[model samples]
Target: MAAVKLPTQRLYGTSFTCQISERNKDPPVGDEVWGTLVKEFSDVPDASAITRITVRLVIAAVLGGVLGFERESKGRSAGLRTHMLVAVGAALFVLGPLQSGMQIGDLSRVLQGVVQGIGFLGAGAIIIRSAQREVEGLTTAASIWATAAIGVMAGLGMEVTAVLSTAIVLVILAAVPHILPTPSETDSKSIGDD
Candidate 1:
């Protein structure tokens, strides 16, 4: 007999099963097409998913925008769009596995990945001037890190928590500065920029 072909194989020491099938790659027709495109967004059908996806994403964006407004008012490089994108991106990272039915325990990996990825982005905001012995963007970097955490909270459906946290962050970014003592004339030049 001719050699039989198996639908499964072991690759990279992991055995996997594979199925060959054809799917309709073409777009759907009529009313079905509309639902097919937006079922996940419809109020009646996918209400829960809508809450998870749309509500969370919007909350993330608004909160991020608030943070961005503060940074932008101060003429920081990482402003509104940057912060909003970071918040929304962080929320999506959590939302994807959540919509896929992954257990809460499995989400730790996703959270870790988001934090590490945001760290790289925050690092970009930092500026170290060795000759001038000045460190800049610390506050901006910290804000990005905190914004990601807030996004994660929003994505987890903690809307109230997200709002409260946003309020607290706004206070830290805005009120705390005015309340703090000003830098001395000698310290002004070397003071870290936001």
Candidate 2:
């Protein structure tokens, strides 16, 4: 990687540098767009890397779907697609940097970012109604967080770990209900008060 100084822009007094490669100084348009497409698909010269990435991504999706399918059957709001997207997105977050030659040690930052970002996404699923004293979507939010972790494991080539983790999550989401009622169910139990 060659160091080439480029232009920087400041927003809110913070500088952001954008690099334009020599080949991309003038991006292709119209008929030449195919070249860009080919370049992207061919970015990874190693055939093994392509297969590795593809398998990992597919595994992540399947594991995520397993969790999502259960939630969808239970009529949860963040169902199949949400869980699948979260998993695939998390997998890409890890895959992209590693494919770009980033070391595993450097991945701590990436993992941290994924966890923080997923937390916000999970937060969106939670709703607290002060008037009713009822909180909803806590389980769905937690499921999304767990799904992200599963995706990360898949991305790191720990497919067995990801599969095992999914099994545990499934047991929690499916089997554990017999022993313990969820927050929403607990709230419903108190509906007699209302």
Error of 1 at 61 (Å): 0.2
Colliding pairs, model 1: none
lDDT of 2 by residue, 23-50 (tens): 6655558547888688878868888988
What's the TM-score of each model vs. the native?
0.75, 0.75
lDDT computed for candidate 2: 0.88
68, model 1: CA deviation in Å? Answer: 0.5
Candidate topping lDDT? 2
Where does candidate 1 stray beyond 4 Å?
1-45, 185-193
Question: Candidate 1's residue-wise lDDT over 1-194, tens digit each?
Answer: 23434577889999887643334433557767787768755533456766567889999999999999999999988999999999999998988898778999999999999999999999999998888877889899999999999999999989899899999999999998787666663466445645
Relative to the true structure, candidate 1 reaches a TM of 0.75
State model 1's lDDT.
0.86
